[model samples]
Target: MTTANLHAPLGAVSVLRLVDGIMNFKTNLVEWNESRQTRKALSQLSAAQLEDIGVTRADIDKL
Candidate 1:
């Protein structure tokens, strides 16, 4: 990126890059939250329930 000069103004390119970065960040954050929630729900299941799905308690963290 070029340095912002006193005589030069920012262009639409810089604005678009910033907006794209913000959107990517927001999407990653949402995915992380959903994954945590799914892990929590899986942890709440009983051994039998987990077995029915072929998952063991020790496998929760690996997921």
Candidate 2:
């Protein structure tokens, strides 16, 4: 095979890897943001309010 043929496949594989990395990063970021929002919402609840939902401030960190 010629040098051009080998380089073409390598270039395509690198592009695919770059795209996959970007997609994985985006998915992780979205999940992290959602978890952060949930934690924030739970932390703002009063003790009674938390108990009504059967959750405690200490347990909130585990979620």
Candidate 3:
């Protein structure tokens, strides 16, 4: 009976770890998508436009 009780908590912990992993994956995907969109928008800006926003042409590729 004691061993059965221990197993139940361990099983719950395993499920929690799986849920955490899924959430981390989702967070990373969203960050990557936002970064890509930012780069795309930056690329569309001319040197003057970029400078107007305080971003240099050299900075665009770096971002």
Listed per model in order, the count of residue pairs whose N, CA or C atoms clash below 3 Å is 0, 0, 0
Q: Give the Å error, residue 28, model 2.
A: 0.7
Candidates' lDDT values, in order? Answer: 0.89, 0.89, 0.85
The sequence of per-residue lDDT tens digits that candidate 1 reaches over residues 4-52 is: 6665356767888899999999999999898889889999999999999
- The Cα RMSD in angstroms, rounded to one decimal, for candidate 1 relative to the true structure is 6.6
lDDT of 2 by residue, 1-63 (tens): 645544556578889999999999999999999988999999998999999999999888886
Q: Which portions of model 2 show Cα errors greater than 4 Å?
A: 1-8
Best by TM-score: 3
Tell me the TM-score of model 3. 0.77
lDDT of 1 at 30: 96
Error of 2 at 42 (Å): 0.7
The residue pairs found clashing in candidate 3 are none
TM-score of each: 0.73, 0.74, 0.77
Q: Is candidate 2 or candidate 3 better by TM-score?
A: 3
